[model samples]
Target: MSEGLKRDYQLCEEIGRGRFGTVFRCFSPESGEFFACKSIDKRLLLDSIDRECLDKEAKIMQLVSGNPNVIQIIDVYEDDSYLHMVMDLCDSSDLYDRVSKRIFSETEAAAVMSPLMEAIEHCHRHGVAHRDIKPDNILFDGRNRLKLSDFGSADCFSDGRSMRGIVGTPYYVAPEVISGRDYNEKVDVWSAGVILYIMLAGIPPFYGESAADIFEAVLRANLRFPTRIFHSVSPAAKDLLRRMLCKDVSRRFSVEQVLRHPWITSGAEGRRDQ
Candidate 1:
């Protein structure tokens, strides 16, 4: 709100833009550290309920800070026209950028997935569900370490309470979410499974021509694994994917279960990046 605060940050340039807001690369004169400043327009928040959602996101980030695998929210300030959030600067591109380039090897995939799984496990332990666990939300740090970002769609889970509202990217939405059924942390596991499938196979198991079609496919479609992509993909990986992506929320594996899966534990030793 004060010019002192504004003057402290040297706005470098725009690094990314998305539906919610624009992210600017900035430097703090006091600490001499770089950060990403995400500015959300108050005007846009007026028309939508996302203002409260954004506030929730800020709180979630504050709760999750100090976890090495999660992005750190350094500061939060709001003015009459905008809400500004300062976060740790991650120079490496997102998983989406990497996946678009080519299918990642099992080693590379495991390298990324290890930290990601840890971060999700941390969130679950703290009663938070990311609700949106897609490639785009998985960012890479300057050291190439994977850090989960964008808590805009995250929600806290209390026992027996179901979140009402359609959230998350279309392709990553869980079956329960699509069916308007009561759901919880398991929904995040489903979305993570979809992400795993993409990382290993280079494509989503479900597809459709429209949003409605995608919703239908997510609800009723059987997950298909492409055996042709990687001849060496183990049965353990396929089985883990099946367990995570199961349409029945009750049947889906928990974050802890998924982390202990053979593909994740046994393969951890052999799967580090070269």
Candidate 2:
């Protein structure tokens, strides 16, 4: 632990762990409040790019911290061996957990997506593109409000500028990214579309036994709403999905457009009986 972090917060039991860091439930004695302390080992960031990405993670989070749908960072600390970030402690299961538990109705899916899109919209408006937007990165606070986190894969962009590099989780990556082409923030919309599809259908629109197969499916961008699974979903919902998952970037819906779509604007009122 960083000496500064050690003196500031009392670290508790491990609550989560990732490739290069571990998240612990910690208490800030001064504030007398709980927050998650994410400590990343400096040694693990072996390359310059790795360290740069780590730095961007905090910068990007701070840039978008104003949004209620995004996690708030309280403070950041770094020592010779580790970098620590103190953020709101959201102990509830992530969006992935909720999706795995059961399929959600169109209304329920909308409830989850409404905030997420807003968060993305806020990020885009600020020039950041969350290269990664999978369910695992979507967390909930004690109140169950969505809080997008984990900016290790996020980057900033300006109008007319496209981001390079192949980033994002396999199941939710946009086709342009897989194609090794320059892309824009619309990639986030594609990933969110995958999440929405899984929410209403309980399965990813693209999948395979291996990552390569999954990437192939993503590049193909063949979308479908199975009769059995989508028969009950509203046409407006399907239309939104089609526009969102469109392979042609020209035809894809922007975050603002998606927000205005009929299904979303209609309050996503769906039958629970489905």
What are the Cα lDDT values of the candidates? 0.83, 0.92
List, residue by residue over 1-274, the lDDT tens digit for candidate 2: 7788889999999999998999999998999999999999989988999999999899998998899999999999998899999998999999999999999988889898899999999999999999999999999999898999999899888766889999999999999999999999999999999999999999999999999999999988889989988888888888899999999999999999999987887778744357
Query: Model 2 compared with the native: what TM-score?
Result: 0.96
Query: Largest TM-score belongs to which candidate?
Result: 2
Collision count of model 2 = 0
Q: Which stretches of candidate 1 lie over 4 Å from their true place?
A: 1-4, 268-274
Give TM per candidate. 0.92, 0.96
Please give the distance, in angstroms, between residue 203's alpha carbon in candidate 1 and its true position after superposition: 1.1
List the pairs of residues colliding in candidate 1. Answer: none
* Per-residue C-alpha lDDT of model 1 across residues 50-166, encoded as one tens digit per residue: 778888999999987888899999888787777888898998888999998887677677777778888999998888888989998999889887889999889988675667568
Q: In angstroms, what RMSD does candidate 1 have relative to the true structure?
A: 2.4
